[model samples]
Target: MCNTFPAVSQVDTGASQHRIESAAALGTLVSSTASYLTVLLSSPAHASASESLSRHHAQVLWDLADIDARTAGLLARILQPFLSIGILLMIIRIVLSWYPQIPGDKLPWSVVVKPTEPVLGPTRRVIQPVGGVDISPIIWVALLSFINEILLGPQGILNLLQRKIDIS
Candidate 1:
């Protein structure tokens, strides 16, 4: 007698694939939402000093002296990644500039010395580089990170967003 076994492969399990696709879509949505919000929050016109103050006033009166928790959470989620990426980019730029050797003339305007009238005789004391010491990049990285983490991190954005939403 010949006995035939049932094929287990014929059983369809489409739910797993659907779940994975749903998860991926959700991730994309969250990332995009965060990015859009970050751009809005960081915009010069939107986050201006005057605008921020107005927003703070609205939040105090309208939101019952409290900010919306959901908005705050979203801002935190978006800003953390953005600030981290900015730090990473700054680090990369610093590293890249170290090897190519940027020209002294091409140095940022802030670091460049301005020409001034000579006080003694017909000569001026031109600023000269005495040695090879470029600490600006290090200082920049430290300052940027400090600003992002301390000043512009969770508290700042949340307060700003609260003010904005409250005003509008």
Candidate 2:
């Protein structure tokens, strides 16, 4: 039997190299995220912030890295949709608050207060009367926006977590 070796074309060789590099990078990211999560979970005070927030940030990065889409990542993915729901709730509340003529006890509008009342109740007490106008919705919107920035913004917690992971 004669042994023969097939010639490797430049394109094939380049593609293989690219795949190898991508795998290496992915491996590094996975390890880094795992290590960081371990430390963060083991020591609650390691990161100075709300425990849940810290966990969420870790989860976000872990998901983005696509190392594993298991528990943490799955939970982290909920934050975006949760925030979207929150914004929608706030908008409905704001609209209803704006037009007193609209009967809120009716269907559709009835559900708006259920989720938003808890938040608006406390906020209304804090914000002084704006010429008899309830500005609590605006305040809530601002607060939610701020939260979104902190948790989901480009230079937000995810980046911070990634940097820390990269450093270690």
Candidate 3:
């Protein structure tokens, strides 16, 4: 029993000594790395190089921003006209709906009906015809108009972006 107790204490002491040595080595390594970093950061040449890199980085960011603004503005200009045309076409479709005599299969009537039907068909499924009249065209008109007003309107996204770009 006495021999067993001394063996256990020896093992415990050895393990504790190993742990302390490992902790001291780790601390020394960490402090050395921290001092190296501190020295590199404090050097005047390193500071100037970092400053120059920062200036270049800022210029690159500004250039990228300018390019993005130009591209977005161009897309906005193209999309605004497309939205307006969509509103115009939807309005024409609504007016044509009033005339029952116009044969839908014929060339002139087909032109309007063909383009508008794809959009109206899905809309009809969601919003059924009311009192024997397909109100899909009206719905599309209101939707298109609303979209046009929201996206390309006076205080719209494109306009706001253009203004911001211009001001900057």
The residue ranges of model 3 lying beyond 4 angstroms of the native Cα positions read 1-67, 166-168
Q: Write the per-residue lDDT of candidate 3 for residues 1-168, one digit (tens) a residue.
A: 112122122222233221112333334434543454466567777547676445544533332333334444675788878777777777777787778788877987787788778998899899987986778888887887787676567886655545663432
Q: Clashing pairs in model 3?
A: none
Superposing every Cα of model 2 onto the true structure, what RMSD results? 14.0
Instruction: Give stretches of model 2 more than 4 Å off.
Output: 1-75, 159-168
**Tens-digit per-residue lDDT, 1-168, candidate 1:** 101101111111242111112333334434544454455567766437556445534432332223354545555676777667656655655554465554434545213211111211122123222355344444555766886766355566455644555333
Query: Each candidate: how many clashes?
Result: 0, 0, 0
Q: Between prediction 1 and prediction 3, which has the larger TM-score?
A: 3
The most accurate candidate by lDDT is 3
On the 0 to 100 scale, the lDDT of residue 118 in model 2 is 85
Compute each candidate's TM-score over C-alphas. 0.33, 0.52, 0.54
Using TM-score as the measure, the top candidate is 3
Quantify all predictions' global Cα lDDT against the true fold.
0.42, 0.58, 0.59
Ranking by lDDT: 3, 2, 1
- Give me candidate 2's TM-score against the actual structure: 0.52
Q: Candidate 1 at residue 94, lDDT? A: 50
After the best TM-score superposition of candidate 3, give how far the Cα of residue 164 lies from its true spot, in angstroms.
Answer: 0.4
